[model samples]
Each structure stands twice: as structure tokens, then as C-alpha cells.
Target: MQTAGDETVITVYIGLGSNLAEPAMQVRRACEALGQLPESRLLACSSLYSSPPMGPPDQPDYINAVAALETTLSPHDLLAELQAIEQAQGRVRERRWGARTLDLDLLLYGDRQIDDQQLTVPHVGLPERAFVLYPLQEIAPTLVIPGQGPLADLVTRCPENGLQRYE
Candidate 1:
């Protein structure tokens, strides 16, 4: 885990998705867990959504949402926290985009961009993921996606496709 010297709170956006083992419950529980991190506080979470699987078509659709958080932990530490929560939720890395009990991604870390072996901020595939874009729009309509564009524009370009509010 890494920490910055300042220890000031930074706002971050997280994307959560799951397609197996009671996904809705998994997501909600994950949100609850976010508020318990060592130096983090959950600020907001988008409504749950149902979207077609981003990978194999045979699997179940995914339940997804985005969360906003204010944290004093560095980006790496925050990533570690998210992975721990997923592990606690029984996440297994069997196959890429395969069904899972939980999928927690560090979508954006205080307007910063990162690309490395372990993770990528603003998600490398953010531009094309309706599941992410929709929920993000709900919580942060005018937020920008760094190199991509404003969240509002991306949401409009994102097709409704197989997504629907999970209500």
C-alpha cells in the first residue's frame, strides 16, 4: 500500500459490477464496505443497473453501479482496498470478464490518469462501456473522462443497448 505525505482527501469514482452469486446484494454490500476503508468515505453511489454481459453472451447480464468517494489513501492503497473487498466477496480471476461475485474497479482517482502493469485509472475501456457510462452519468453527469470527453456527451453517444435500470 502507498500513501501520500499530505494525507489530504481526494475525490475518486469507482465502478462496480457483478454477474454472479447474488450480484445486487454483492454490489450493495460492496458500497457498505467502501465506507469502512481505513481513510476513505463513500460519498455517493449510482442506482443499480442491469446490462448485457460485456464478454461471453451466454452468461447472465451484469448488475452495475458507480460510487464516489473521498479518501486520504493514495491511489495504489485505494486499489488495494478495492481488491480486498472483492476478495472478501469471493471474486475469482478465472477468465477475463467472466461471471464473478464482485468486480470493483478504480475508475478515476481525482482527475489523475495512470497506466501501468497493475491498473489503469479512468479504465482503458471506459469509452465503450455502456454499463459504466450510464451509471457514471447518473452520479456525475458533467464529469469529464480525461482524454475521452465530458460525461454528458459520452452518455448520449452510448447506446441504450441492453442496459436498463435495475429498480
Candidate 2:
């Protein structure tokens, strides 16, 4: 963790997804919102990506992206902030991977490995999901996923599975 004056700052990464209410726009707006969070600065955001749904196949395609941040917010606090953003975008927890206006995941928190009920840093699925890995690789090519290996290696092993850069 780096010190921002007296406050401690941690490098964090966020995964973004949407398949409802103009998905692309939702992701773009969400990306902008990440920059507005308190005690945080949006360092970089990957290009928007289009990917097949991970859950029910009947839903519309999803617009996805990854965002990197330098923040002083604690892990739980950051998770709460992400949930708030999702709630504001009309997110409802109806089913796992159900359609939603927005889904913001706290992918990483400064190499910290957390497995609490509320949050999991280096997200549980980060290593396998192409939607998450590809975009993450774009923004942080040199990143090492705490318990997992290098981002580049993971990207090489994961199949595209219809994931593509959004035009």
C-alpha cells in the first residue's frame, strides 16, 4: 500500500458488466463513475468488450470492461461503493448471473487475498473467465493475481469463448 499523505492507498481493479438498459452505455457510464469515487482515482480502463453470457443463455449479450484504481477506501467500503453503483443502475439480485443494468465486481485489492463472506479479492473466477481476464490484461499487463499466477499466462490459457472487443 502506498501512502497518500497520511492515508493509505491500495491499487484496485474493478470488473464491469451490463446486459440490460443499453449495456454499452451502462458500462461507459459506470466507468466514468469509478473516477468519481471518494479517495480514489481511476488510473486506467480497458476497452469495452462484448461477451456471451455466463449464465442463462437467453439473456442479451453483455458489455464488459475492467477498471484500475488507486484508492484509500477499505475493501468492504469499496465493495459497498460498487454495490451502490449497481443498485443505482437498477440491479436486482434475482438469480445468479441474471440480467442486470450493471454489475461491478471488486476484482483485486492490492494483492490482498480475501475470502470473507462479503468480498473476495482476486475474484474467485478471475483466472478462468475470459471476459474478466482479457480486459484485465489490457489494463494491467504486468499484474500478478495474488494467489494465482501472472495475468499474461492466464490470458494465454483461457479460451476466447466468443469474447471480443466492442466496436
Candidate 3:
């Protein structure tokens, strides 16, 4: 965390995904909403990407992106705000990795490794998800996941998995 006067600010990375309700628009709008988050400023957002679903093959393809934010909110507090954004965008918890209107994941919280029941920084699947890694590389190519080594190395090891940059 960086000290700005008395407040502590952390750079966070959020993974955004949606396969329902015009996904690309959902992701773009969510990025806008992130910029509006209290005690946070959106630093960078990657271009949208299209990828095959990671869960049920029967579901539609997903639109994904990564966003960088510098926030004074604590990890859990930042996570709560992210969940609120997902809910406001019509996200539902029907099933694990099910298709959704919006999915916002707290991928990283500064350089911290958090393993609480409510959230996990450097997201549990961050190392293997191409959709997450690719967009993340676009925005923060030099980032080193708190526990997962360097971003570029991870990207090199993770296949495209049918993920493509959205035109």
C-alpha cells in the first residue's frame, strides 16, 4: 500500500466477464462503474476479449477484460464494492461458473496474498485462465502475481484457449 497523507492506497486488478445480456457492453459499462467507485480511481482497462466458456460447454462464449484500480479501500472493502457492481449489473449466483450477466473478480490487491473465505487475491484461477491473463498482460504486462511469479511467464505458459481480442 502506498501512503497518500494518512490514507493507504493499493493498486488492484479486477477481472470482468459476462456471457449474458450483451457481454461486451456489460464489461465496458462495468469498467465505467469501477471508475466511479468511492475511494478508488480506475487506472487502466484492457481491450475486450472473447473466449470460450471455462465452465459448461453449453453456455455462450464470454467477454472478458481486466481493470487496474488504485484504491484506498481495504481488500475486503474493495471486494464488497466489486460484488456490488456485479449485482448492480444483474449478476446472479445460480451455479458455480455458470453464465452470468456480469462477473467481477478481485484478481489482485496490491502485492498482498489473501486467502480468506470471502475472497482470494491473485484469484484462485489466475495462473491458468487465459482470458484473465491475456487482458491482464495488456494492462500490466510487468505485474508479478503475489504468489504466482511474473505475468509474462504465466502468459507464455497459458495457451490462448480460443481467446481472442474483440475487434
Candidate 4:
């Protein structure tokens, strides 16, 4: 439960994805839930992108997007809220990169670095995932990836093929 000193608001970027049961609708619902948080406001949202699955190759394609938020909640608290939303959407952690109703990942937290068993800020794998980087670049092109360079550069280097921006 890391809190911002003096109750300052922290800006954060979150990545959302889903491949089951009206994914776009689920993502929209999740965004609404974020706005319902007591100390959080949805600041920006990237256009949706459709992409093939990342891990095992036998799943449906996914709809992905990135969102920006200003919040007084700590990183861990935000993560918990996201998990609750996922559970409400019937998400079950059965397999890695498996089909899901909702998948929410915290991409960055105001230039902060966090390394814990349950959560990692500036998400470790975000730089290499087109589903994350492409949409992230739309909303926050100048975003720096902690150890990496600007997000736009990383989006160019990401090898994910068949990523199409949604209409």
C-alpha cells in the first residue's frame, strides 16, 4: 500500500485486453469502473486495436487498448481494484495468456519503479508487446519506459504482426 506523499494525485497508464464475450464491451465497462473509483479519474484512452494472441497460438484474437488515469490510490490499491473488475467480469486465471473476459495491467505509475512478487510498475514486458505499446503510443507518445527509451521508439521495434487499429 504505497501512498503518494501529502495525498498528491499520481498519473498512471493501464493496459486492457480481452478475447472473450464481447471484449470491446468488457473493456468499456472496465473503463467505467475505473472512473467509479473514489480517487481516480479516467484521463485518456487509446483507440482499440485488434491483435492475435501473444502466447499459445490456439486462442481467439484480442481487443486491446491503453488508458491514462489520475488517481490518489497507490499502485497496489489500483491493482486490487482492477482485479475486482476482472472478477466481476468472470475472469479466471487458468493459464498464461489464456482467453479471458478482462485483463488489466498497470503499465506505468508516474515514473515510479516497483518490484514486488504481485506487481511490477512500468510493467516488465510492456516494451515488447505491441498490444500494449501501440495503443500506449497513441495516448502517450512521449512516455519513457524507465530503462528503455521513448514509447514511440519501442512501438516501432515491436515485432507483433497483424495488429490493426480498430475503426
Cα-lDDT of candidate 1: 0.89
Pick the winner on lDDT between candidates 2 and 4.
2
Span of ten consecutive residues with least summed lDDT in model 4: 1-10
CA lDDT, candidate 3, residue 126: 92
Q: What global local distance difference test value does model 3 have?
A: 0.94
Considering lDDT, which of the candidate structures 1 and 3 is the better prediction for this target? 3
Say which prediction, candidate 1 or candidate 2, comes out ahead on lDDT: 2
Model 1 CA deviation exceeding 4 Å by range: 1-5
Looking at candidate 4, what is the lDDT of residue 10? 84
- Angstrom error at residue 94, model 2: 1.0
Candidate 4: residue 9 lDDT (0-100): 88
Write one digit per residue (lDDT tens) for candidate 1, span 1-167. 23457567788999999999999999999999998998787989999999989888889999999999989888898999999999999999999889999999998887788999988988987878888988888888889887777988888887978899997
Candidate 1 global Cα RMSD: 2.8
Q: How close is candidate 1 to the true structure, as a TM-score?
A: 0.94
lDDT of each: 0.89, 0.94, 0.94, 0.88
TM-score of 2: 0.98
Off by over 4 Å in 2: none
Candidate 3 stretches greater than 4 Å from native = none
What TM-score do all the candidates reach, one by one?
0.94, 0.98, 0.98, 0.93
